[model samples]
Target: MTSTDTATREETPSAHVGPRFRPDIEGMRAIAIGLVVVYHAGVSRLPGGFVGVDVFFVISGFLITGLLVREVTTTGRVSLARFYARRAKRLLPATGLVLIVTVLLTWLTVSAVRWREFGVDVVSAATYVVNWRLAARSVDYLAEDVGASPVQHFWSLAVEEQFYIVWPLLLVAIAWLLRRRPGLRPRRVMAVGIAAVIVPSFAYSVYLTSANPATAFFVTPTRLWELGIGAFVAIGATLWTRVPRVAAIVLGWAGFVAVVGSGFLLTTEVAWPGYAALVPTLGTAAMIVAGYTSGRAGVAGLLSWRPAVWVGGISYSLYLWHWPLIVAATAYWGELSGWWGLVVMAVAVVPSWLSLKLIENPIRFAPALSRSNRLALSVGGNFTAVGVVAGLVLVLLVPSTSAPAVTGGASGSGVSGAGALSGTSAPAGTVDSLAEVEGYVPSVVDAEDDVPPYPEECQVDQVSPDPVVCEWGDTEGDLTVALVGDSKAMQYYSPLDAIAKDEGWRIVSMTKSACGFHDGMQVASGEPYTSCAEWNDAVVENLLDLSPDVLVTSERINDALTDPTDVTTRSVDAMVEAMTRQWTTVTEAGIPMVVIADNPSPGDVSPVYECIADNDGDLAACTFDRERGTADSGAAAQLPAARAVEGVRVVDVRDAICPRSRCVPVIGGVLVYRQTSHITDTYARSMQATLAAALVPQVEAATEDAEGS
Candidate 1:
């Protein structure tokens, strides 16, 4: 076969040094990239298309292992310098260019609020360590509502790069240790080493995916076994010669089905790269083995089609360019529709083709760099430097809009937040027009951090079923007041804290992010939130046992729920029923309740604080329609549920939050919403007097009834 054919046969970072170029492998690359592209583009049909990255991992392992094995058998030693140099030349040019482009695009198009975090992500991506960064952020409760980073897809690339860095050294060590043996071949020893890796890694993947899927999805250890599966196939290539043609043909087709069908059958709801990942990785192994053993009789005839090969030729560049383009487009024009996502994919191809033609190929195949490992490594370093420098520049460019600390809850600076609306108090700086966001208590840049300060470990996170009960204000008091529900209820704690201290009531808090306090199954990340259900049961049991004087609850029940009968739907009827049942149980136990109606959301407006910053503090531009915000809030269910339970009163400060049919971003001098749905600590604290005026009388009435009973 010609050199061109050979190169095409062993595409990707580590090319195969095997006997012949396998066109089927290149075609597989096309299939893999296509699945990933469609999935990222929001094509609803292929929810599990993310399995494409696992397939690429298998392919990389097979090719890289084969290359290392060949070098070892011929020269008696593996060269780490040459192997890594080849990887750098094959991958870095396009990656660096894309990183730089993403940085500039984000700064120009996305909000300044995202710039600092995006810059950190870009730097991590440039260094091929972004997966760890993403894993950390994935489990961070504060970052739960953060938008997708433009370079977030780099996590997979990071995993593959990490594998490439370590695999050769491991093989070299195994080969040396087995060198002193007489009968043992290095291949056999390598096979043992590969198994050692695959078993523990797969076990850990299963464990972590179950216990903490968010972190599990991005970490390196959980994915190492996928690459090892490919390595196993490469090491055992000789055994495939004995396989019968009929069996090989059957396996080939089955393997193809497993890979393609996984994209359709699985979804984002499934815990990934755990046992579920076996379908695609093993299927890839089967295809590679079938190609070697059965040749033309295998699935190669279909996979080796011209279009497939052409697409495969540019898959790497295509993968690098597609995601950032999608993010940038989304930032420029709101969330992309299915058609717009497809359009963005098409637009991405222009840059993908240009980078492949002008940069990726020419540098990868250049005579000087190809001949000298030192020169190739140097060029790679320069490219990486470009990406890192660009990232730092973006970080430095983050606007210095930090505001001085403002006194919260009955603002000492005369900035009475909700007091202005309730006619209780008005800020000296309060604008009569309320047209702009200037003089806001928390500057737009600091708005995200303007959340209530709970004691450490006071609130449970999304994954755990464990309940945390924290007490603030008058631990030794005559009356017990409990705050219960999701983060929405947690946001109201500042105002309650001030009231509890003033009234000499003990305040108890039990809250979890993304979890409602009702006994219904909620959905998180498109899957049944079993932990949420468990937490609800556990917390309710504790509350019933404690029999607090009054239970104050609120939640953003906008998420869908799985009914008791196991049908998941977005209908609020299920939530209303669930809330009524739970509230009845608590009220029957002599714990009267106050339901704080959920506040208006910054619905569909991504990065709400950023929008305020971008508009030069024009709060009017950031105002959402009151009808839309209120309809989407949990008040739809909260109001009805409160009526169904005796002694359960609802405290609605909606008028203070959204005056005159308009939900404003700032009230009085305080910025209101901290995230998409939850109000800021400053805003909640500002609304203290209003909440107390509405809440205390109801609590006293409930207390009197409980005492009489």
Candidate 2:
């Protein structure tokens, strides 16, 4: 019989009435926890160590489903409230402690902007919606640019909690159906359900793994099959027990090998939870089944050892506490500290162990409280902890009035009151206050009414020009205006579409992901520029034929110029000359040409918001220095190349960002930059006025001079 089926003959007075301990399970937990710790500590050998979480999922599914199955086999019904109460007792104490400590650490160390961002995560985590939130944000967990989130790792926990909420109801329904149909076996039904869910979910996971890896990695739906693998094993324990001891031992060894092999073989690039995930998850199931069936004490004895059991016992707390501590430490140190980060992980385990022993175990097994009282305490404590966390986050989010006013400064220097632009000088002639336009510059266009109309025939889905056509504005006017360059150019659609509306120009957007307007430079995706060159050729041919009044383009020549040593190479210089030639083509065609500057290079700041939030409201502490923001040699090269062109007016938003000594990310009252490198949409909108100011005068002057000619 399964351990879960063996109820204690002696009834205890305690509210915590369950199996006293399961050492073999604890040993499995040790393996899973150990993999995670070693992986995060930068053990290069275990690159696929993240699969440890998948192992945990299977283990949880097996154990939890085994308990439900056993309970329903004996009793007529499963108690949903009682099951949830048990989950609360198991999960909340450690989670609540971690959240509180993380908040305290963040308040002391993180900046205001980062704190606010983390607060949103904290709230999402508390509500068990972190998975959806991260997916919505398009966060790539594996990407180096991902910023520190104090609670990002909790996305898994959120998935688990969500499972807990629904799993009991499904289990109860299954039990009820079995009670009605004596002919139908519960085990067979469960087996079919597991197969039905696991097979298709695995297929979908594999498909999504390559298409949108980030979504596939974090979403619970994609990962559900891993848990189902464990559920299948739990229902088939009777068949598993019939296997010989030696065969069981062999299966156990094979399963262990699979887990270790998966950890070493699978990588961030592979499609996960598809076929790849079956190795570790099925292996874990195999080991669990083997341990149960094998009469041989060797494998079971090893798993039941005291040290392994202890680590396994505290695994939940360890998982909960380790990530935030590591993330916070990394944020403070400014990089993943390699070996030094191991020390932080080690330090985190102490508190986690203590909490497991003192707080979690005591509350879980306490006898003084009745079942209803224990339930009340668990529910009340969880909500109260959530409330306290939310309240503290609100206190941090409220902007500080003590912050000094940032005035306009001298050219290329600090903000000075003397150089501040008057309210009348603000573009669009609608903004009335200097303070309103000071750090806040709306981008060139604000509304659909601001730009002109587009023609019906010009409306197209793809960002390429066939007959050099485009939908100009809300009205769909067909006055063709070409949009050219790379993904950087694509990001300008919000501003460019607005401009097109204001000018009554049809936006013939011709863009590629990272392929700039350069002649022969490599594109951003590391591919040769054959497709980019052909696309540019096609665009130039279309634009020449259409004879659009204005040509708008952005220079991503910086993407091709990576090495500082090769800054002046013939190829690099030729790329610059080609960009100048394109400008000449526009000017020669009697078209007003405008070139927008490329944005700053990307950075390694996935948890930037969390870092800022941790630092309280100190902008100086959280913001990356100018050097960190623009470390690329190519960004500087593009600036001079643009300036070299005589008639082309280079629109530089750098002045608005870097008033002096390079650009610090803070602007107005908000954190201007989202990551360490890219300016947030919030900050980007603030610069709209400055961008408009820079472009309007040049465009107006050209228009007036053309009329005179």
Candidate 3:
């Protein structure tokens, strides 16, 4: 749009032409992949290394749309089969090879607990739908904390493939519908369609980002605008008089700076692929546009240099190789920093180059495999192979069925019976044995505590305004114990269920995924989680009416009352203020509620399951520092609020969770954390005795107070 005057094109017949292979674009690929690899390896100073994916998005939009536009201009038709064949040839060979190898290596090196989800990741990546699957997983608070899958990088590829599938069909539809209209040329029709999508997609991206940032990051529509910008550049290409050489040089250099420097300047903490993404997308588009001006003064010379072009040529393979290697490196070595990160990155090149030569080039350019049908068959074969590998990994990589029960048994953790330690009383908790997580069971990582059997009848999802009514505990028990809050509260279910049956208490759990019970904090991306507020309102009404014998509630406190404005991060005052109102309803009604302190975080960046697997069951190496481990826990902040109310009791398990200098991965012969911060249901169940010891007395006192009232 900036290149030429629209009036000059009124009389000239457009010369339809195929795009020449631009080395500069290859250079751009090098830059994009370089940023991505370095950032992911944790070797770069750039916090925004992820912006490289945005550059790739723009480049893909430009290249793919250029091909389609050229085809339509010359032949007035686009072949979906041929386009897909090319994509399959260009992408699938190396992708499938890497996926198969990654699966094998992950099985050998990573934990068994990750195998099941990684198995699904294999399928999702093979089918190029991993982005959507990841999007669903992102919003799930339970699944949200697991380790990054080796193929998680495939999400960008999945987005591009999804674009490829839809863009051509949309262009073809526009062409067919406008066949007789000379005013609506194929390029113009395509432009109109793309414009139609870009405006709403960008708007939705901003809105959804503010509402659900995690889902927005992976969803296609949110990323559509960045790609659409590239498409616009391709279809709207205009010839123009060159700008002053100095101006072009400055412009190109500036654009390059924006693209590369963004990584150093930006942090992942900010909401992304939103407006912030414009920095790299525009930078990429500007670089491409400036390259066309025919000058050595611009970035053209640097981008087209031999090393840049070569790296760009193998960038796809490198991208596939780098992430898995980094994941493995970090898992094995525990935080690959300084020279170690670079060494890990360098090792990936050998496999990347091999894939390029042995797997990628041979199949991609082979004369026999060039045909669309042959390529289609190859895609099918590769997909089938991947599926088989996934199945085998799931079957063979699982934990031993004969593994000893977690409780009162000795296992790999080396401590006998229930206690990893002999001096402490029953070693402070229960776990069947440390073998549950110590075995690195695939099901443990894959199946979140939020799943069935415990209770889901009254569970509310993130967006569900209405709560489902589910009942648990002894149906006719004399006393009622109502559990409430987010999935963090639901983590207590197994233990509470056990206690309920044993103590003859009726248990009713009112829970929501990711929603907190803090009245002051409206849960949403940046806006109010209207559903959570409504559900809280409804729960308050229910509590007013039912007023169970005892109310036990907990939330992802950090999510609940975390005021971004508070520099201290511990917003006890705000939490106390917000929670006081919610507690008031129960307090005024003379019902006693217990605010069970949230558990210590198991370190999201370094899950013990992965670390233990990587280090050959070295439990001490998997432990997280006590101070750093529980820093984000909302438990401390929630205390004042719980204490502020009448008829409210507090129960903190911090000592139980992080009893030593560091929070051990395996405690009392049981896995302490299932994923990141949530306690394993087994671990929670095992803590029943300790929980009963700490909780039963207070709960009994509360029940007596309630009965007296």
Candidate 4:
């Protein structure tokens, strides 16, 4: 969320006029950017350093609104073009510079597999729509595990840009309307307008944050209230008379405590930009108000120190340069922690100082650009030209992204542990074939063509209360397998479809995005996923009405780990309990249930595909410790759950994945997983023979046992 205002205060009309140099406010900018950069760099002491962005939002709102109010008061009419032109001059140059540099660096250094995605992020960053895009991406279940992109920081800039898009026009409308009413001063009318916006936007923010915090954090609507609060302060500041020194000092110290203390007090686990935002939002507003008093007093005095002011001078460029350095450093070390993080921040100073002295100041305050709106228009045009050129360069640069790493070794022959079961548990022989000829980005492929997913109506999201069953794989066949649960449950489609087609069976897909087959609530962003529980009951009813020959269920284990308490214990117990209850319904109805074990997720954060890409053609370099890599096969968590259900049988496929002592990155020359956890369609097709061998018998036995009873 880097902003144009981070280092300079040219946007504020108040700053340009009376009391021009507010060292206190500039120092505040230093504090905000410091928190944001440290938090992003993985400072263990400051988990809540992200609150710095909230502080930025408030400052922006205060400053920008101050400018707008001044324009309305002085001009008696607002020129939208001139206002936007000034904005373009102030914001576009540095932003465009960063985007170009970041894109160039990403293309050169990032894994080829991620270039296509990161390039797209560059486009979004260039246009200032990255925040909304990020918000949408956050809710996408498949995109959940992907690593952070370099331009992820642009989302904050996008939010502020979007705010400016409508705000000036809105103020113009308010000013025009107030002119018709002779008694209303511009300040009074603006305050009324600010209050009106704050009330509903704040309520909506609170509601959205509670309902969808992940999206809420990136969306403009949720953060608008914070900006509105700042605007309120700006308008009130115009009307506020001077206060006593003692009281003002007390307020300043209080603001400092609130702003700095929040870093230690808050955690990201809480739903943000909601009421949790008040601590930082109000504190920043207080700090700004305190700065208005004459002389160095309280927090203002502390902020006025030379070291803080120097950093504050370079704050914008520092914010710009720090993130990409951290990203590059992280990619080099394979991780960033402790001293490494501080090292990255220290190294970023070179670029930050260079950018400040070179790019930002030169263009931002150029004399030629100072006269007419020519500079503003030219900056806008120049940005378009450079942005277009950069986009084209990126496209040409990554012509052939390395395909998802599909290795060609034949299946491994065995597991080595003493207690490791032989025969059934042993790895298949010699994984020697490549399922895919080249490594492609699996997330993109999986999103589009991973498997034949049921339509949106059938593959439900959180909002769908009604379940729609879609059939494939010999839909006319007499034997019906009703596959149900969350996306993890949906992931089996590739193998199951192949199996059903070969065996003359109907495969009915009844799945939701994150809702597992269990009645227990699924958690996301630390909140009980809404609509999932209701959808569950509705799905179970739909399943009963269909009464297929075999009931199939699977769930991504991690999605159900929403509990903040002993997560492993709670998740396992919940899965077991939910499976018992749901399966009881099917078994009582004379239908047999078959549970497919969840696959092992490859890396802790980065997928094996990314690691393989990062490490060059050496796939072995990406091989993880079977203990850590395949650590929690939702399959393991699901073992007792599958066993406790009457008339339910479990089919194991872990042997197919982790055939050796460790979970190999590639099996039979094919990439075992196209996604972080889910197997690729091509790989899943290769495993069709194995899945059929394991699945068919248990399904038949369950059917036979039901009939015999």
Quantify all predictions' global Cα lDDT against the true fold: 0.80, 0.60, 0.70, 0.71
How many angstroms is residue 537 displaced in model 3 relative to the true structure, after the best TM-score fit?
A: 6.5
**Highest TM-score: which candidate?**
1
For candidate 1, give the lDDT of residue 572.
81
Better of 1 and 2 by TM-score: 1
- The order of the candidates by lDDT, greatest first, is 1, 4, 3, 2
- Which tens-of-lDDT digit does each residue in 1-709 have in candidate 3? 0000011122112224333456777788888888888888776587788998998888878777777777777777788877777666667767777778878777766767677778888878877788998998876655654668887888888888777778899888876776667577676678899998789989998888766778889988898888888888777665312456676677778889999889789987778777888899999888877766637768988998879988887777788888888877776566778578778788898998997889766776677666556666666467647655664566466664223344332233443322334365443332322333444322234324323355444567676666655567787899988888887787777767777888888887788877777565554544446677778788887877787888888876564445534333445566667788878777788778888888777664355565665555665566666766666676755777776787889887667666766676666555566655776665665566667777778889998887787
**Model 1 C-alpha lDDT per residue in residues 1-709, reported as the tens digit of each score:** 0001113433422223346667788888888989999998899999989999988888878877888877777677888888878888888888899999999899888888778888989999999898999998886667866689998999988988887767888988876776666467877888998999899999999999988898898998999999899888878877776778888888888999999999999988788878999999999899988876666767977788889878777888888899999999998897898788989998888898999899988998899997999999999898998889988999999866643345544476767777667544433223334653346667766667888888748778888898999999788878998988888887877888878888888988899887776877777766677888899999999998888998988888754464543445657877888888888988888888999888777686535677777786666677777788877888878888899988888888877677666677777778777777777788788778888888888888878888998
In candidate 2, what are the lDDT values of residues 19-107, reduced to their tens digit? 33446777878888888887887778788888888888888777777776667666867887666666666566666777778787766
- The Cα error of candidate 2 at residue 138, in Å, is 3.1
Q: What is the total number of backbone clashes in candidate 1?
A: 0
Error of 3 at 480 (Å): 5.8
Backbone clash pairs for candidate 1 read none
Of the pair 1 and 3, which is ahead by lDDT?
1
Clashes per model (N, Cα, C within 3 A): 0, 42, 13, 19
Give the distance in Å from residue 29's predicted Cα in candidate 4 to where it truly belongs.
0.7
Candidate 2 ranges with C-alpha deviation above 4 Å? 1-21, 139-146, 295-298, 368-370, 373-398, 406-478, 484-503, 506-551, 555-557, 560-594, 599-709
TM-score of each candidate structure, all chains considered together: 0.89, 0.73, 0.80, 0.87
